[model samples]
Target: MGYSRLNVVIRADASVHIGMGHRVRSEVLAEAFSEQGAEVCFVVHASCADFSKEGDFVFGSESEWHELAHQADILVLDHYGYDAAAINALFQLNPNLLVLDDNNNRGDFNCRWLLNPLSLRYSETVQFPLTGGQCAQLRPQFSKYRAVNPIGQQKLLLTFGGTDPLELTLPFIKSLFVKGFPTEFLLIMVGSGVQNAKEIQDYCRQHHMECQIGVNQVSELMAQSRFAISAAGGTLFELACMGVPTHFIQVADNQKDALAEHSALGWCSATDFTGCLPKQRVSLIDKVVESVLKTWQTDLTQRSQLARECVDGLGAWRVVETVLASRLVK
Candidate 1:
């Protein structure tokens, strides 16, 4: 079977509200598919007319989607907006459909394969395949980042998703200052499309903290970090693979499941700020930061081991291989 003849279409979105995890994940998958000689096209959704045009924008109606679905060899859905019924419609058009999801609540899946990298543990109650499907237990992208940096050169990393809609970056920096931000560990903050980018940069400059915007080298930074403060999302898996200890906050409601379960599994130090008020958040931030600072290394060895064991960083390859093999059999 020639993979070069295969065509894969990935449908996902990136916006302030939905976050950029889906878009980034789709890109990763696209690169993997392309590496295997598959023709991949990413059809990102535009939320509304008011939504700013970014990336490769494709406009089409439902009929157009059906048309494309008919021509595509495989259709990959990684959006929360797509329910099982909606997915079923696309499945009928193309039986070779892949659904990438974090939440196991998407009811029944009618796709050829289901990949849920978010949920590391395999259980009987899980919605997707436990052993047969591509779960991406160990992400392949983190291979370069797996090597731990010298402890003395490590910094404290800060990242709040791609958009940082909650504007948690600056406030978290201020909280650190309130607790007398340690000069020993350099602060590194990263974000794209953040509303408060200028303010954060100014604050960072004034306070001598490093602020990076629209960066593509996060895995590199994660490798050089002693610890990271990040939103509980896809980055969790990356951090785990890099063996970087993190303090996580569930900035979005959809992140609750992954964050809670990963934290329970001792992946990172975490707290839920879904509905936290200003005063309460300030207090909680201070407490969480201080607690992490004190015992950050208590389980560092074990956490890093679990992370390396769970996230091998070859998820993309596994996905490409599985999907292609399934195609040949059909």
Candidate 2:
């Protein structure tokens, strides 16, 4: 409730099902708005509230979407759980609708602003009856990020998003330990989709990689880490903007093209997961550790610079302004 005049509402959700990237990005934009003197309220499904990214006033009820929208100058939706009717419900009450759509599924939303950042590889995900310009690639608001300070090469960040369903995170940590990678401070981010917290705990003890699971302060961890081993989803952009060198894993087919395209451009490295079994995936962790340390030892300056240039930030800020501008025009 930092703003005295405007109330901005962000409706997004994170689950073991939809994954954490959705909420992570939503939080990024909402926190930015909060710092700019906006009272940001988040409307989410009750079951998904506990896993939601921090900050903002929270409303955990599906029936509350329109009600919350009525109180805001802008409504930002970043979840796939809702379809056209759910989204239109909010739009019916407010002229401004900002949707963070992946897959370009809702390419036709009747809204003021629509974000299809980096475009969507899974066309069916957003090729819906919704009407709005498909414009997710309109640049991000990384410059407007509310996080302070930066990671001066202390720890390594590992985030595989929502499920970590493959149980890949802790296995990788053990590989790092076996390979004797520096364990001064390792921050591991996972989602409820992963039921292996206990296993992660035991492995961390065995190798003592200062790693933890299910961290809520993921941005803070990214800001603190020297580099990252991440799934090629939303976090890729965040890591690039943070200037953290990254090695990517495609956890799903939905993410294949983005990962491959970015890797080919040297924005990051891609480890193919197609038809790769779980045990085989574990072995790849060894390759990741080896590759990471080797890259650091050989040429780091070029890597960091590349990452910084790929995502210069400001995406969320641009999105917010776009929505607001559309509202003003009407």
RMSD of 1: 3.3
TM-score of each: 0.88, 0.73
Tens digit of lDDT per residue, candidate 1, span 1-330? 458888788787777777778877788888888878888876755453233334443655667566666778888888888887888888888777788878767676576777877644433322334231134533344776576454642677888877787778887888777777574465655567677888889988898777778777777777777778888888888887787777888887777777766677675778788899876877887877787667654646676665556576778778777777663313
lDDT for model 1, please.
0.71
Which residues of candidate 1, in runs, are more than 4 Å off?
Answer: 48-57, 119-134, 137-141, 148-153, 297-299, 328-330
Task: Name the 10 consecutive residues with the lowest summed lDDT in model 1.
Answer: 125-134
Residue 256 of model 2: what lDDT?
Answer: 72
Off by over 4 Å in 2: 1-3, 52-64, 83-93, 119-156, 179-194, 212-226, 274-280, 284-297, 325-330
Alpha carbon deviation, residue 250, candidate 2 (Å): 1.7
Q: lDDT of all the models against the reference?
A: 0.71, 0.65
Candidate 1's displacement at residue 151, Å, is 4.0
Query: Using TM-score as the measure, which candidate wins?
Result: 1
